[model samples]
Target: MPSLIRPVLATGSLNRAPQPTLPADGGLVLRPWRAEDAPAVHEAYQDPLLHQWHGRSSGCEQEAAGWIARWRASWETERGAQWAVADGGTDELLGRVALRQVLLGDGVAEVAYWTVARARGRGVAVRATTALTRWALEDVGFHRLELMHSTANRASCRVATKAGFAPEGTRRSALLHPDGWHDMHLHARVRGD
Candidate 1:
């Protein structure tokens, strides 16, 4: 009988990885969110598309500030990493890319991202997703990364596909939105894939 399991090297606690600026073409870069970025965060959340899919957003400066604070706390606790996708030249916020649901014990994590309206159709999400995936799989040593989206979110599907996440299957009624239960498309990528 062949062994069915491969041992994953333990990565230990997720100490904040040396916040490196990831590659982003067309004068974009991935960096940590800043206090002053609250306005941008607030503005991005104003897009109806974000509210439709995410179900929540920073409606005001206070909320956006708290949102950024939570992200910082998550980094401290090894729960997640949220990076601001920004224009490298102007430091203008374009969008966000994140690694969430980090289960180090299982060597797995999930990638999520959204682009502001101004950043849409520019491949910002795809590039940011790809960069984050590489950093998680290579630098952070996660064995697998998952990307799930509402089935109706075709644009997200494309982003996941372009970022090298292959669709596995659908999870019926996996998520609940404002309207009702939503079927989710599951996609995943393993290290070296």
Candidate 2:
């Protein structure tokens, strides 16, 4: 028996093509991850701060390649949408942005992203995330999008705020990092907001 509530998005509503590249302000484009980016991803994962925040490492280019393959496969599975934030002209990767834990029926996903060392202070994550949020909420019909980061990560708070995700509240001892459990701040944006 069907429930009373209607799905915010239909099962077959999304696709990877037709608008695969999401354009951002500045010269940034959010494109699908490529195998060639393994080296850069591997290198980015080596940053101690990134390692601490993400709690995972690429370990090698091959592993990063596997990750890229999985990111591509997610589009077909309708589980997630990941993008490589790259320069529109040079095609050099600057960061990554993703809609993770996608729930199509509910029209919700959590945003995730990271910027390379060279891109960190330049607002790459903010631009890429803003582009993705617009695409998901405006173009793709998601009802809501959420962003969460460790409270200790002040930079991420800035990115989330700048990207239009207003802080909802905090979850205590929410995530485990290498150091220990850390509290997280929840932020979100909804349709028409």
Candidate 3:
């Protein structure tokens, strides 16, 4: 079975260098999550909106630390990448962004994110998503990137459009939240687009 298409992006490429800190507009920086951010992460999860949309919580500072560990390790594993959205001037934790379900051979991955209540409605998600998408598609050579969210998540839909992800279609009952199953809307960006 050697007669086949080669991988679009090599696996080791991502782990070759340390994950980068991406700078976005509006004085935002997307950096690697640090150990000390555990407390802030834990507190952010307490927001009801987070539970409503994400359906998961940090539960404790220790669990949040585990999240930090897992995200940091993902870089080395080359399975995914994540960043903490911080205020460039103050270095305050504000949100998170990630490329999840990365498939190097297919040159595709899913984009996901959330912002703290204080940072919402201020375009934080849009800026972070734009920065991460550029890095993933332009710098890292991914062919396509996906942004999927519940159809009920109008905020995420707005962020996707602002970040240049074109609307694809709706996937009926694609995800389960704490409340119930939700219809998922898929938005995507191809490299040349």
- The candidate maximizing lDDT is 3
lDDT of 1 by residue, 6-107 (tens): 535344346635556787767778998888988889999989899889988675899999999998677777778889999889888999998898777778
C-alpha displacement of 167 in model 1, angstroms?
A: 0.2
Clash list (residue pairs), candidate 3:
none
lDDT of 2 by residue, 1-193 (tens): 9799999988767664532888998999999888899998999888888888899988899999999999988887888989999999999888899989999999999999998888989989989999999989998899999999999999999999999999999999999999999999999999999
Query: What CA root-mean-square deviation does each model show from the true structure?
Result: 3.2, 1.2, 0.7
TM-score ranking, best first: 3, 2, 1
Which residue pairs in candidate 2 collide? none
TM-score of 3: 0.98
Model 3: which ten-residue window has the lowest total lDDT? 1-10
Would you list the C-alpha lDDT of every candidate in the order shown?
Answer: 0.87, 0.91, 0.95
Error of 3 at 129 (Å): 0.3
Of 1 and 2, which scores higher on lDDT? 2
> Candidate 1 local accuracy as lDDT?
0.87
